[model samples]
Target: MKCCFGFVTLFVCSASVQAQEANALVQQVKARLEKVADYQATAQMDINVPFINAPSSEVQVFYRRPDKFRVQKPQGISVLPKGGVRINLAALLAGNNYTVVDAGTAAVGGFNTRVVKLLPSDESGPVVLSTLYIDAAQPVIRKTTVVAREGGSYEMLFDYGRYTAWGLPDKVTFVFSAKEFKMPKGVTFDYEKSGPKKDPPKGDGKGRVVLTYKSYTINKGVPDAVFKD
Candidate 1:
């Protein structure tokens, strides 16, 4: 009877420890995301959409405040979005926006990781679904899978080398589905299409976009003048 009781006690303790760990991970991720009120960083972005008959474009992006962003491409006109900040890539893609549930364990970036599934409340949202691989010890998200509502999924792997107080990732590699990918020419009408499609190019299948951000200045006093057209 004593031996049976001891086994039962050990099982209960193990279950309790796992539950505590799961809760702690959720809080850690939430706190890290909430720390960034405002930040300025330079990013190198590579975008590829197979459906679009154009070569991949590499651009540099500068971000400021509530809804200010500027993207500059070599030998191309810069894209500056003033008021409507439709999307905050870092926050929407990497930050906390979904319910996290512990899926299990896996190996990622040569580290033992805990896989967490992020489920969105609204099924009809632009992002269909996402799954994240978080480093168990560092408690930072290392990789993510984003499923688009339009039947395409993108996988992004983050290699966080430099650690900031806010725990933001410096480098991210985006690997997207290569089949039937395409960006509307109207959106990038300024650029000449050079891929398989003609002037008004169609979509393709596969693509990838890798972004590297350097030297983040967070929470600086950025006024309205900085974001003015």
Candidate 2:
């Protein structure tokens, strides 16, 4: 009986150690991101929706400073800047206003990871929820899932190869639900939805968007003119 009790005690201790290690991993990733000041990259966005015959691809030039970001997409459609407009997406959303709930563990990109869910305090805000899959072995973020209040859930996968130590991802892929996809015409009343529309194409319910960062010139004293149209 004593031997059996000892084994049970050992198991409980091991479990506790594992949990602490996972928490430490998350803290490491956050620390690395906090060190980054700015970065720039090229992004390829592919939006696939139901009733659309083909997926739409847009080439974007992205500039991120601490809490703010500028995304220049095709057709002059720009996203509104929020969260200080200088921080990276991860840091921006994980600010003091949001709450981070540890959602246990999961395997991402073959790496053992801990899932951290970020929920905004303001429910009426643009984003509903954001979850991050952080690699336990290294301080790198492997995947991200975002749910917009007005839009649907989006899953993003990051492939950190060349810039693994830099804490900046080399590639990112996006997958989203089709029901949330809306036609621009629906908003502008330019195009009308014909008869019964078919559901969007499904491929493992996953879509991908990859971003490649060429270079980052830090604190180069960028002039105000660069920000103007």
Candidate 3:
């Protein structure tokens, strides 16, 4: 009986240590992003939602230290999915309100990454669950899967380039569910937007948006007014 008790105690301690390791790794990644105070970038966005037909557009992306992020279109309507603009990793990894579980490891974008799942204690929040794939060598998040309470779940994959030094991705791709996608209230679509209607969505209820960045003006002090409605 004493031997069995010791075994159980050992297992519990090992799990605790694993959780601590995972949490520390996450904080390290967050610390890396903390280096960049602010940035503005010009990104060419490709929109491909099942129910919507819209042409690609050039948009301005802005981010300020802490939790401010916004995407702006040069002209015309915005096609971002509901709750889709929260792609800032620095903001997402902020605070210690969530429970982290060590979910083992996986390969993302040809790089081996450690997988960790974050579950928010406050269930009422928009995010239900988030899984992060962190490349420990680069110490950057290669992919993220977020399940939200409202506008449906989405997955984001990151590709690093020149801005890898700041732990920023040069490209980001989002794949989300179109079935629950909601437009802004009182918004309507014109059938003659750019071209003919897209074919009805297929069996997979997924939609995708790709943002390929042109350039980033980093740490240049973006004004608070840039984020205002």
Candidate 4:
């Protein structure tokens, strides 16, 4: 009986340790990102899908800490993923109302990193789950997978350089379902690539949007109006 009790105790301690480690990793990522109050980035947005006739457009991305984000294009159209705000890893993990679970390790962006799963405590929240691939040594998040409450999932991959110190990525790629995206009527598209919209392709056909950050201005305090519609 004593031996059985000892084994149970050990299991409980092991679980506790794992939980603490996972939380620590998340806190470390937040600490690294706390340095940047705001940032402005010049990006080139590319929409890659069979039915979309979107050409690459020059975009300006503005972000402020604790969830203020916006993307602007001078004249062209920008097709971003549905949950654009959650793409920012820092903002995603900033809230403490989620539970974290260690999901073992995986190779992300050529680096072996730890995978942590986040589930929002709020049952009705838009974000159902978020998974992060974190590099503890470099202390950066290389990729993230977010599942929405509406039964759709999207993934974001980050590549860093130049703005590495600020925990900012030089490039970000988002993969999501094309069916979830819709454009307003009367907005003329070139339709060179998009032949005809036949009832909108059914099933989970994936679409890719890549953002190449050409330059970044960090800690410059982007105003509230920058994120306005």
Candidate 5:
């Protein structure tokens, strides 16, 4: 009986240590990302869907502290996925109360990463669960899978190059459910001329949005007017 008790105690201790390590790693990533006060990013957005065909569009991305985000187009229209703003790492990790579990190691985009699962303590929050694959050597997150309280889930993958120090990715790919997506027809006035709408893939109705960042102006104070609704 004593031997069995000792084995159980050891297992519990091991689990506790792993949980602590995972939490600490998440804290390190949050600290690194908290350095950027604001940034303006120039990017190219490509939209591919069964209904709409959009040419590569030049876009400007603006971000400010505590959940301010705006995506703008200089010449043409821009349509983004619903719940897209959750892609911001800083915003995702903003909540202080949560549980982190170490999901172990995985290879993402040819880089080895530590996968961690975040479960928000608040039951009423919009996010049900989030899984992140973080590069072990860098403070950057390579991928994220967010499961919303609503039906479908979304996934985002990141590839880093020039802005690795700032924890920003040069390219990002977002995958989401097509059924949950909406684009205002007024915004894409020329969308129908692009092509005849085809039925989306059979099963899950998924679509992809790829964005490539051309340049970033970091630490500039963005005016509140820019983010006003």
Candidate 6:
């Protein structure tokens, strides 16, 4: 679900997601994810921002255990949510550096999911707080709301199909705010200086990036150079 005021309002929703057995639930999902050491997937990524003109294109997504991720779009640039956010859920849940609480319940993809809230103990970490909607029957995170310590905050909705066994989503939707989105570093644009600056463009600041996976090659060793490039 989308919160009106971002992280602040989410606390009202987070009750006890990180608990005694709540950690057990977290471990179950993490164990399910451990089945796959790595995978390379082909996806069609679409960007929907009210402010920018962008086209949908195919991209190659790669991931390795513990935290190695890359999005490859040949001869083009891929715009995605930033803020030290890694798409891999494993990377997000890795370590016992956080406390948990039960956020409540929600429905995702027609499944009732338990909402779990995670508060990272490390103040220096990029992720400040995270809310996870976990599937009731299986060990999979159906949705997530993440607030970065810096500036970005986004929610992820997962639609599983072909790779549900591995906790991989067939289609993932990332919802964010366009007005709050920062351009990639080293990028600059020309803007009209109408008397220093005018009021920011008026519109609902909703931003979305959708990735539909066409296929996945599981357990394949993705070379380390893929992430370095």
Name the best candidate (by lDDT).
3
What's the lDDT for candidate 3? 0.79
104-220, model 6: which lDDT tens digit per residue?
678877899888888988899888889999986888998998887765577888899889989889998877666644432222212112124323334655666688999999997
In candidate 6 the C-alpha lDDT for residue 211 amounts to 88
Per residue, candidate 2 scores C-alpha lDDT tens digits across 32-125 of 7766555555555443445443333444444444444555556655533332111244454445576666688899868887887767888787
- The clash count for each model shown is 17, 10, 0, 0, 0, 7
Candidate 1 residue spans exceeding 4 A from truth:
1-20, 47-90, 93-98, 183-206, 221-229
Cα-based lDDT at residue 50, candidate 4: 53
Per-candidate TM-scores read 0.65, 0.64, 0.86, 0.84, 0.86, 0.79
RMSD (CA, Å), candidate 1 to true, equals 6.1
Give the poorly placed runs of model 3, Cα more than 4 Å off: 76-85, 180-196, 200-205
CA-lDDT, candidates in order: 0.58, 0.57, 0.79, 0.76, 0.77, 0.74
Q: Whose lDDT is higher: candidate 2's or candidate 6's?
A: 6
Error of 3 at 54 (Å): 2.2
Please give, for residues 47-155, the per-residue lDDT of candidate 5 as tens digits. 6666766677788888876566667778434333234237678888886878899898999879989999999999887788999998868878999998877645778
Please list the Cα RMSD from the true structure of every candidate, rounded to 1 decimal place: 6.1, 6.0, 3.3, 4.5, 3.7, 9.0
Q: Clashing residue pairs, candidate 3?
A: none
Candidate 6 has an lDDT of: 0.74
| Model 2 / residue 128 / CA error / Å | 3.0
Position 56, candidate 3: lDDT: 81
Alpha-carbon deviation at 73 in model 4, angstroms: 0.8
Cα lDDT, model 5, residue 112: 89
